[model samples]
Target: MRILVVEDEEAIAEGLKFNFEQEGYEVVVATDGHEALAAVSQTDAEEFALIVLDLMLPGLSGYEVLRELRQKQVMTPVLVLSARTLSEDKILAFDLGGDQYMTKPFALREILSRVKSLIHRHQSIRLSTPAAPADPAPAAEQSSSTQGSSPGRFQFGRVIVNFQTFQVSVGERVHSLTTLELELLKYFIEHQGEVLSRTRILNHVWDEHAEVTTRTIDNFVLRLRKLIEPDPSKPVHILSVRGTGYRFLPFPSSQDVTDEEFAE
Candidate 1:
């Protein structure tokens, strides 16, 4: 697999390139955000299985590069490495569609582990997606009633989620959910009404060597609430269990109770 290493530090970039090359991956180095953008644009977005990005750069910030990539619908997995260890910085990175974040002075072994895990997960997701039909069906024959209500869809409250497309419709606004958010939500849906601890959540959602704090999970849950809850401050679907972690109540009482409420 090919990997892109975007870092302004020449020594760090060279080191990463060498290490990734040693692991049998074609490594491409981009010294700055501008170079990174150029490299990504010049090649097929899927040509690189993963991108290792640094926050500080000479031409443009890593945040900007990430934003532009997502804006262009480039869905390649990105693992952000930065010296900025602040929680806010990490939160911003994830919110901006980063697949993973690592604070600097990080171990190379851990990064390698995360890279392998992310690539595996990404490939699995891609493989599981059903391909389009070889013969096209006429638009007139298509059914609108079951358009977004497939088996891969989940609807609750004012939210309609199509897991296949990662498209979420909340009320009148439609939003594209990040991979982590979608995975977290899928996990919650699969284990509805069960209280999940932070450790379990981390084990399930992130790699074993992923350098993320429990508080980061809380932030992600908060973001999920903002997307699904009518009022994020007073969430009903993803309820907090006091000293414990969280409980996923797929059929919250606030909405009209029905046997066919949760995802089928």
Candidate 2:
């Protein structure tokens, strides 16, 4: 397995590289976010098994790097190591598609364990399912009858999602979804109408070794609502269960009303 460690701190970066190398895994170090992005671009983007990312960097902030990577649909699992312990910071990291996060003074053994677990889980998922094509046929070019008609595609209200391509469309406007957003949407569709607790979501969507807070889950839910809900202020699809968690209603009551009601 190969790992990329992106950190501006020389001592910390070297220590991680050394420890990871000792475990028989190849390690590459990048002192800044730009260098890290450059390295990923130069190599096979999918070749690296894991990435150790730091939030504070010289060239680009970790948030920017993470956002760009996800924008480009790079699915490499990222494990964030940062001194910032604020819930907001952690939430932002997860929202930007980070797979795991650890505080600055984290134990080396724990990091190693998390890395191994992430790699194993990722490989298992890949083996179980066909990897998405590097560049799928554009959704617009597909036959109208086949659009959102296959098992891999789904439609709700005016929104259409192509799971295989990670493409989402609202009405006629197409949008690119982050990896995490796509995963969460898929989970919701699979468990439609079931109330999902924050803990349940965190366990299912994030790395098992990740130290995630429920607040992070809330943030993600809010973002999803913005994308899928017709009126985010009065959400009818992703309904909060008061003290419980949230429920996903694929066909909300508002959309199910008769034509007479709509005419009224």
Q: Relative to the true structure, how large is the alpha-carbon lDDT of every model?
A: 0.78, 0.76
Q: If scored against the real structure, what TM-score would every candidate get?
A: 0.77, 0.74
Candidate 2 regions off by >4 Å?
A: 21-25, 71-75, 120-179, 255-264
- Which 10 residues in a row give candidate 2 its minimum summed lDDT? 126-135
Output the TM-score of candidate 1. 0.77
Q: List the residue pairs that clash in candidate 1.
A: none
Top candidate (TM-score): 1
Q: Model 2, range 119-191, lDDT digits (tens) per residue?
A: 7766554322222212234566545464333455776557777765566778887765645566777777767
